[model samples]
Target: MKVKGHCLCEKVEFSISVESKRFDACHCSMCLRWGGGPALTVEAENGVDFADEAFVKVYSSSQWAERGFCSHCGTHLFYRLKEGNFWNVPLGVLEDRNSFEFSTQIFVDHKLGNYDFANKTKMMTEEDVLKAFGAET
Candidate 1:
């Protein structure tokens, strides 16, 4: 499905191609520090189309992935893998939020004691995530 959304200030708008409404919450340390909580995201294939790309600032968060946000309002946008043209876009930023489900939780071992979700999701530990992506565990 194709979804459209904008940043907090609306200075940055985008349209991305996604597979389903089901999203995942990442509890990795990098994700927690980036958004002050779990990064709820939906997988988007290929890439995203930004209205004005200048407003989107990207940070190389890891060797294989990077994060993008609105430079103006600092709204967390997407976490993109450098290879395979894959993107994990924040669900909160998507315009049509209906019918979305919390499906998985990645890096479950890195989750802190401060918060958690009640829904029973398919939790994957750091090792599982790394192995699934063919990365070094």
Candidate 2:
């Protein structure tokens, strides 16, 4: 499916072709610090095209992944794998929120006790995430 989205200030806009409607949540420390909570994201592994690219700033958050956001509004955009063009766009930015399914949660061990989801999701720990992404633990 092709989904359209934009940043808070509307300075950065994008259209992504996604293969699945399933979304995942990341509860790693960095993600928590970045968004003050788990990042709910949808796999946009097929392709993505951005407009007003100059307003977007990408931060290399880890050795294997980078996070993108709007420089003007500081709205979180997407997290992308460095090895490939694989991208995970934040669910909050998408125009339509009714179609996606919560399928997985990564860094599950790091998730805090204060909040929980009712959804039965596939949970992965840090080590599992590393292995699944071909990264060193």
Candidate 3:
């Protein structure tokens, strides 16, 4: 399915194709510190078309991943891998966030102990995630 979305100020608009409405909550430390909460993202590894590309800033958060945001509104947009052209867009920035269903929680070992979600999601610990990504453990 194709979905359209934009940043808070609407300065950065994009349309991406999604295979499913399943999204994941990343509970890694980097994710928590990035937005003060788990990053809820849906994979959109291909066909991401941006309208105002100039308004989007890409920050290399890690050796393997880069994070994109709207320079105008500071709205976190996407997490992209340097290799494989992999992308995980933040669900909150999508126009149809309500359609997505919770499917997984990555970095479960690092999730904040202060709160828990009511939804039952497949949990992946840090080691599991690292192994899956072939990232350093």
Candidate 4:
């Protein structure tokens, strides 16, 4: 599927080619702290292209990954793997959010106690996430 989206200030716009209509939520400490809650994202493993790259700023949040946001609006754009073409884009930024399905949650063990989702998602703990991504815990 191809999805188009823009930043809150409309200064940054992008389009992504995704293989699935499914999205995942990340409950890791970094993710939660970055967004002030779980980071609900959709994988754009196929490709992503930005219309106004200058409006976007990327922060190297980790050794293996980087996070991007709109410089003008501070809207989170994506969390991307530095070594690959894979990108996890925030679901809220997408124009057609109604078609996406919540399929999984990563770093489930790090999820806070204050909230929970009713969806039947495949949950993976921090350890599982580390192993899946070949990262040291």
- TM-scores for candidates 1 onward, in order: 0.94, 0.92, 0.95, 0.94
TM-score, cand. 2: 0.92
Candidate 2 Cα misplacement greater than 4 A, ranges: none
Candidate 4 residue pairs in backbone clash: none
**Per-residue lDDT of 8-105 in model 4, one digit per residue for the tens?**
99999999988889999999999989999999999996656998799899999988889999998999999998887888899999998889999999
Tens digits of lDDT, candidate 2, 97-129: 678989999999999999998999999999998
lDDT of 4 at 126: 82
Go through the candidates in order and give each one's C-alpha lDDT.
0.89, 0.89, 0.90, 0.91
Looking at model 2, residue 109 earns an lDDT score of: 93
Model 3 scores worst on lDDT over the 10 consecutive residues at 45-54
lDDT of 3 by residue, 23-107 (tens): 9999998999999899999999594699779999999998888999999899998998888878999999899999999999998
Report how far residue 131 has shifted in candidate 4, in Å: 2.6
lDDT by residue for model 1 over 37-109, one digit each (tens)?
8889988876888888988999999988899999999998889988888888899999986668989999999
Q: Which is the better candidate, 2 or 4, if ranked by lDDT?
A: 4
When sorted by lDDT, best at the front, the candidate numbers are 4, 3, 1, 2
